[model samples]
Target: MRRMLTVCAAVAVAGTVVAAPAMAVAGGEAAGSGAAPWMVTVAFKGDEPLVQRESCGGALIAPDRVATAAHCLDHVDPTHLEVHVGGGTLSEDPGKVVPIKGWSVEPGFRLIPSPVDPQDFEKSSAADDVAVIKLARSVFGVPTLPVARTAPAPGSTVDLFGHGLTQAPDPKNPAAALGDQLKHAQLKVLDDGACAAGLASPGLLDGKSVLCTQGAATVCPGDSGGPLVQNGRLVGIVSFGGETAGKQCGEPTVDGFADAAVARSFLTQPRPPLAPMAAADPVITGTKAAGDTLTCEAPKWTIKPEKTEYAWYYNKVDPANGFEFYLPVEGATTPTLKVTDELAGHKLNCGITASTAGGTILQYSDVF
Candidate 1:
């Protein structure tokens, strides 16, 4: 059976490689930062610089919001994600990093496993794979790309842009880096019958929710959530790719995107309540010595949380492994924790979990 990958947009996660549902410009030319000023770099907080953490690409659809593929963030925590906008050819520029406040995936979104091998993601496909992200603050000066009111005709040509792999990742070259510069490609829209005929999982393409395409140049990993533009408006988001003949690069297979028009309602709908966002980390006050009472204050949040909860933990030294580990104190759900002799010689810390209708977030304070 032929392989159809989700473009592997996400980088290594805790040492495991996950196929990201985005693509990059393969057999295409480099694009300037101005080429798509509304372009966005979706990334996670990591030890590396923001540019090095590029997971998926996105397009700014509102002053304080961006549109991307749901798979790129469906299982991800909003607090750990950030968007880089208004950058140069690079993944990020000075002062362009914006933390994600919250996000919502299309209610109907689903990922279909390959009939040949469920363990193999190279043959996986998706349905209704779109999402909208709320930024911590509004970004001015840059122009936002409006979602197309209707799907483009099958024979029409469209452009795709992204910060993804320039070519299919080689198994032999596992250390190869992802594309840092943005790039663009032109592809022709494919009709439903033509699209299904070329895909390993044709049943996943409903024609309305998916926009199919093909061309000499195509999208590779990291391009997921990147914009597919027709006449200056967003028509689709890079979703997945399939190989009918050649490799995963140029002219290799049919590509799929989350139809922007089909997702218009979810994209343009009124904003919902945002997940809890902390302005500061939790603070632990009081003496560290045993027999002293310690109080942990909830971190200030931009939006008031509906509820706040706390937990106390102690770092203990294990005599067997000689390694330190943390253990939660029993019934430490209040704002105060009374230290006892048993906690002596152990480091203590507090965690505050803030929750709202939108989502929940947990923040921990430095060890006391």
Candidate 2:
């Protein structure tokens, strides 16, 4: 998938449109049956500017971040990536330009393209197929979309937005245009029968987990790394396309695309790994309820945040093979855990000790 060719390419690929808006071709998974009214405009570093109309594009994932296909950044440098919002057109009033500060894709990305073989058809061809961009400054004048935690289950609907390979009033060669404005398109999920509609180009779809949709979200020479949103959450990045060879934008073989979990795995350094809870001195914030569920609470979680492992001990022992507590509990996610403590009519003492790849954040709770 080449970035300048209406898809993802460098350091590499990755948006959507909106009256509400529509975009096409990205992760091949289904989204919910709703429309995400958002999209973004991008500019390549050292390029003339957004004035060209098709320098780049992306999908909004946060107030200041846009998820994109890493391949699109190839040839170009991050220093040149800029976003524009408000009033819809890429044209600006000088003050409307929003520059990108810092961002990251998976560290395992490859700056080059992957080749296709007639024998085996798999999607894992290139090392660098996806990427993300963080705005250098907080964007104003535009509404952004949210990111989802996982891919939408099968059978859901997906929405897209971008400048597709729309022809000018007069027909011309596909490569004739130096600057092309992105177009908007919508694709409804097709059944298994339609998934394999056009497989002429081996570079596009490899058959597995493909999405079949009607209409054209096809090759737009410049729509890459756009956001695939569902339930108001961004779940996928436009990394690949299913257009025919020499075509600008093509219909997507896969209607929807995304597995949020897969993209998250690319984080070379994840928020330093969420600090896990260590067993604390026992605390029953509330007593057992009539439903036979005991209310349990843990002490405030405190971890210095270093390379380490965590262990919660109950009665001086790791409960449930170092998992479910040996004591009663309630439901909470942090150090002050609150899971229903099924252990009743038993006295318990709990505490924790955390270990890291570097060392351990040590704290022994009192034996309660």
Candidate 3:
């Protein structure tokens, strides 16, 4: 049996609503004066008519790359996917129409099985849902947005922009349709536990790879593949939404997003290498006078080490002796070594060992 998955698109069908949120970029207003320039309206190019068919929303992350939802273009041909940027609305003419030269989908994304269980729907939607489209030629004049490497903390607010419907469909009037104006909404990031609880699914939300938003505003149909901006950075892509009991848009419990950090590898070219760890030797601090406490100061490192060890030793025989011997101080595993009366005339020192992924570094402090 085919399983059903809920996707956040504007298209409507009979029996089931394709699992997308409701119309009018529901609960949002016109993006207005401060609209993002990187916003783009995605559509299909037909053979019969050279017209651009608007489908979803996307953000330009590079001169020739756009980031969107995997589900938006999963079934469509890459050559037919057209990207229109610097537009006020889908109905109005955008600055330029760029043809997609190539595209890539998150490797882990999979189709939801038909007749899917309600409990498992969220898990299916939360999986890799990101995609990147490379344009046929480099786009100039329009500024590209940067992708955020980390997700915003829960309770943080984000702005969503799309060319989806401006109002929810009237249930009584089944003929009501979505709008073509670019709209935007402010939504708060919900805690993973809270989002999962609201959806009645446990362990279904992955905080690192998925973002859940809850509030009066959310993405609706035609809003799929839109950009979720936090601090002016592209942190997520609109993916799916949970339906209400009425099976209509508006007042959704939570809307889902494909995390941009998880999709970073696909959006950028020539990925940078990881830096090596630089660790310094430990130093001895505090008064070294007899009967006073002498402390071993751990060295500062460029990268934090996983583990650290400290060892204290004291000279047990006179240095004048050709065979002077040093012995480990019992119960002195810590960084602090107390100078007792018995060790009044003995030389004391500390040895430090720091371990990291690169390798282990060992150093010793001067005798006190």
Task: Identify the leading candidate in terms of lDDT.
Answer: 1
Candidate 1, 1-368: lDDT as tens digits: 21212222212222222222234433455665478888888877787866467788889999988998877866454666778885555634523787677876777777777665666655577788888888879999889999999999999999888766554555665324356666777888999999988787566566768989887666665677888999999999988874322235433578888999999988888876565666677899888777888899776676677888889999978899999989999998899988899876788999877766554566788888
Off by over 4 Å in 3: 1-27, 46-52, 111-124, 168-176, 243-246, 270-368
RMSD of each: 7.1, 19.5, 22.1
Q: By lDDT, is 1 or 3 better? A: 1
Lowest summed lDDT window (length 10), candidate 3: 1-10
| Top candidate when judged by TM-score against the true structure | 1
Tens-digit per-residue lDDT, 38-127, candidate 3: 987777665522122557788999888888887776534343457888777554546478866556556666544212354443334546
Q: Name the better of 2 and 3 by lDDT.
A: 3
* Inter-residue clash pairs, candidate 1: 4-122, 8-20, 9-20, 22-224, 23-220, 23-223, 23-224, 24-220
Using TM-score, rank the candidates from best to worst.
1, 3, 2
Q: Distance (Å) between predicted and true CA of 304, model 3?
A: 46
What does the lDDT come to for candidate 3? 0.64
> Estimated TM-score per prediction?
0.69, 0.50, 0.61
